[model samples]
Target chain A: MSATTLTIQRVSPDAIARVIDDAPLEPFGLTDAHRRALAARLGAITTDHHRRLDSWLVERGGRVAARFAWSPLAARRLLGSGGFRRALRGRAASIRDGVRDEIEDLLARAASGRAHRGSLGDWLAHRHPAELALVQASAVEWARILAETGATVTGDWTVASADAYYDVERARTTLRARRDLLVLDGEVVVRVRAGGPTPSAGPGLRADLAAAAFAHPDGRAPRRYVGIWPDAGVILAVDGTLANVRAGTRDLVRATIALHRQGELRAA
Target chain B: MTPTTTPARSILEDLRGDRSERPPRDIETAAGLRATLDAELLAIRSVPARTSPLVISASDVTHHGDAVDITHATSGRLRGALIGQLIRLVAVGHEIIDPFDDALRAWRLDSPSPTLIAAYADLDANGRARLATDVAAHAASLRRALADVPSAWAVRTAVRARVPLAGGVVVLHDVVDLVVGSYCDASSSTVLLDVTTSPIGRSATSLLGFHAFVHCLRTSVVPLRVAIFSTATGELISRDVDETWLELAANDVLDVARRA
Candidate 1:
């Protein structure tokens, strides 16, 4: 781990394009040992109690509510889905039209009893037009920001969905991870943020990458993680190496302890 | 009272420059301007390390009109805040039903102010009626001036740009009311519009320049123009973003930083 080097670059949008395009393809071979090691580390933390940890919990420091609410997370879920890709591809007159069509489809699904209650579709159905307009506006801005990064839905690039890893011994303890987009069959992971870079961004991103590795079905870790902050016009690319993943695992453990302390305080 | 005669053109039409006239793309010039501002700001000792950074807004650079006692909410301030929300609704082409209610709902959506809500609750029947009348008049004026913004231009409301300088010690923040068009690398095409309830004042130009400056630094693409529309008097003022305006804005920021 000491011999491995972790590369992180903070650059402009255009330069980030080059960074993503010019990333070195490193060989990643993850065996059951690696998966077992990660699981063991997480399971050790949740041994005392059941815990569901995700990048948000590890990075932002909070408890995940039992129910979904209207927040940027919902927007992110839509942005990183195939439905949004289809919406973008539609020959709509305007971005708002595309978004409206997407919402209408969701409404139809909800009417047909396909969508779960308290989901984005269910929640949006009860919202006012003014609120929906705001959603449309968000979709438009996100689309524009993504386009500025020279990222397209075509080729090997596909929107990545959230992945979860449950503890073998503790079924209640799970680790969920998600990235905005991935390409080269999950070798490269991309996450888009709303604002500027922060002091905690690097560690947070590393933890995300680590969670992705733990939850990956093939037990393979990504080679790179690219974070794009459109509002701040900054991009961060971090290499995924064994040493870095170990460091990220440490971050996750610390965050889990902190969360447990908070929960204990609430109980007290 | 509403204007006796309708204007020949809407405020959006007046501010939306010719689509054929593409501003020249000078990435070098933009980069140089940003470098200059960064250097000037980096030299300032406005905020010390391990301390909360100083945030400079347009109001910090120039006089923000006559000061009112903020401890107590005034009808004028409430009207202004509502009008601002109404402009946001209009920018997104939301249907305006019951100007006062729509404005209040929009305002609460963006910022839920308990004090303002309490203030509104305290308003007597006559006072509430007068406030509603004023908001309706302002809504009419806004509608008359803004007309219908085409959805194709991708209008964004309350677009905020916060550019940190001097290693995050000093942050320049500004929010443009309405942004039209997209950022083009080949040429400048984005237009920023600021909606004000009051008549255009002397500091309007400075505010516009400050917005343009912060936007350029944030997006790295210089906007084509920055315009301000006054719903109070149906006045519109727009200026093409040039090196001069950006320099002036930088100086204004430096002045504020020096004072800090």
Candidate 2:
């Protein structure tokens, strides 16, 4: 077929997942090229370093991560004095304190555009496999859950190439969110693990909600955040309470820094 | 390939011909057997989902033997996943190198044993040497089986099956090691194979039977044959899924359900 006359067919991610879950003997039936494509795309797609650190924070603070993160008392006090942007900026401080230098160093490097992936890989190389496995396995199972529920996405949720943008309504600042999976009823931000003591909602989902709130022109945000373990088939959902968001943002800031410390931003 | 049959062949081909070794399916007897099987299925479905789904695996049905054997057998399973990756590559037509190098490369991006790459990296020289030799040998055995596999056959690896019972309250679930060809019970259109790293410390034939039974339940069709490849000894045990064979599998499934 002529290139102009040929119509390109794009399979939606949901369609791809549906085919997999429903069909018992599909892989063998598809063309080799399609099978390879599906295989490559298989597994949990969300499990970024920043997300993992937020997960780590969920471990440290447990419920406190939400109480202090969603809308911290201090951030609220700052908001009374300044605009929403200033309050948001104020929220940054609580998070930066625990992990400032690492954040500045890594974010600056990413901003400089040295080699974000190299940064990601160096960090992954040092991490124990269990952590990565937990992240990946959980991601895979979460995908299965999404398919089972017949959830659909309005935008591309593909990782590796996706750039999530979270806008701060008050400050007009945009926070980039690269989450694993986002279910957009009111946005269920999922962070999955294969094996781990299932902690309650972590900083990753909270930060996502925080970003969504700031980004929304209407100031509307995702209502819930999730921490999932696929192997255990366990899910921990925490509501988007203001206090939890404040704590989550705080954890998010620290995680942003930790990822920088963890990653190496140089060419392979 | 999945459990589907083509119209070109007959589902009852095995039972219809006088050339068959297994006894023919007698309609009257089969009718009675079907009722009994359905009753077992209903009994299985009777258990509440809260009491854990009535799921059983080929391994669960297989005799694992005594403790020392069990320990050895268990450890061997840990490597099956890693080795299975190589077999998968072979299935998809990849040229495999030495076990260590190919495994290191293929598993770098994706592997169930997420830390295996690092664990391999952490190994001392002798440890590394031992691992490489063992993996390379196993890889060679799997490749031999692949060579025997028809290129035209559809090869599905690590195929997961959940045969819902009692209307989804209970399930008979398993991850079939590998399934080849398309399948339908009437036609015996598909072939299923399971690969083990070590020699059979236990009679893996029952495991194959479980695989056959699950396939039949998941897709109302019987597989033509179920086989097991012992990579350690390069031994393959295969059984044709006759009506009699499938009936025995039904009995086994019911046995588990009755105990449950």
DockQ of all candidate complexes: 0.35, 0.03
Candidate 1 regions exceeding 4 Å error are: A2-13, A27-29, A47-50, A61-68, A71-84, A109-117, A150-171, A183-186, B1-10, B46-50, B64-74, B113-115
Question: Which tens-of-lDDT digit does each residue in A1-268 have in candidate 2?
Answer: 1111101111222332332222222111113342233223221222232232234443444222333321111221121122212212454232112122222333456566653464532333333333223222222222333322223334333221132464322222235543445443334454434332222334545555555454444444445544443222234444555555455555655554443444434223
Residue A12 displacement in candidate 2 (angstroms): 25
Candidate 1 C-alpha lDDT tens digits along B149-253: 776665767676667776677788787888876664556777898877776767777888898888877766778888887777777778888887788888898
lDDT tens readout by residue for model 1, A106-221: 77887888888878777767666666555555565565555455343233665554553635343246665657777677788887776677777777777777777777776566
Against the hidden true structure, what lDDT does model 1 obtain?
Answer: 0.68
Model 1 chain A, TM-score vs. native: 0.81
Which run of 10 residues does model 1 chain B get worst, by summed lDDT? B64-73
Q: Which pairs clash in the backbone of model 1?
A: none
Which residue ranges in model 2 land beyond 4 Å of their true spot?
A: A1-268, B1-38, B41-51, B64-74, B104-128, B148-152, B184-187
